[model samples]
Target: MAIQRILAEETVSVTEMRKHPTDFFTDHPIAILNKNQTAGYMVGKELFETMVDLIRQLQPQESFTATFQPSVTHLKAVTKGSAEFLVKANKEELGDFVE
Candidate 1:
């Protein structure tokens, strides 16, 4: 899926994740989607980096694991634009958008 479309359709934000990490992960596994939205794979390093930043922001001294999830409400809030949803990638990372 196009990054823009993903941002438009699904809501994922640091605040939401921080609020209900467990629920969020349960509902949304970390994945990278192609521009066509047809294929996606589980993300590791990239997702880990993003989550680390989020966790640190919310709980500086707390350690987090990949199993965390966020609440449904928090997810909705992100999609609705109550919180900022960001997806950062360089041109190389965004190979799906090249064409």
Candidate 2:
């Protein structure tokens, strides 16, 4: 099974959300998780765990959010430096996904 992740960076202001997005936050780079890409894929649970570990290893200070995909047995998260870490961890997993 192959798991996929897409990372998007956006500047979200306090007005965008009803509550504060972070405890002590700044307007720096933020990761946005997408589960739509994981739908209908035959990914495994271990793949998700591997991704989480790899992501945390890359950006220790960043916050990550995950959305489970019941349709595919996978999870997606919005985290910093995912593309760079994925390329270093598993080049094949990146497989032209990173630009």
Q: TM-score of the candidate numbered 1?
A: 0.21
Mind giving the per-residue lDDT tens digits that candidate 2 earns over 1-74? Answer: 57654343443333432265443233333332233332122223565567668988887576566675454323
C-alpha lDDT score of every prediction, in listed order: 0.51, 0.45
Every candidate's CA RMSD = 20.1, 20.5
Candidate achieving the largest TM-score: 2
For model 2, give the RMSD to the true fold.
20.5
Can you list the residue pairs that collide in candidate 2?
none
Task: Please give the TM-score that candidate 2 achieves against the real structure.
Answer: 0.22
lDDT of model 1 at residue 94?
61
Residues 11-78 of candidate 1 have per-residue lDDT tens digits of: 44554445664554433354334434523333345566787688788974665556758899988887
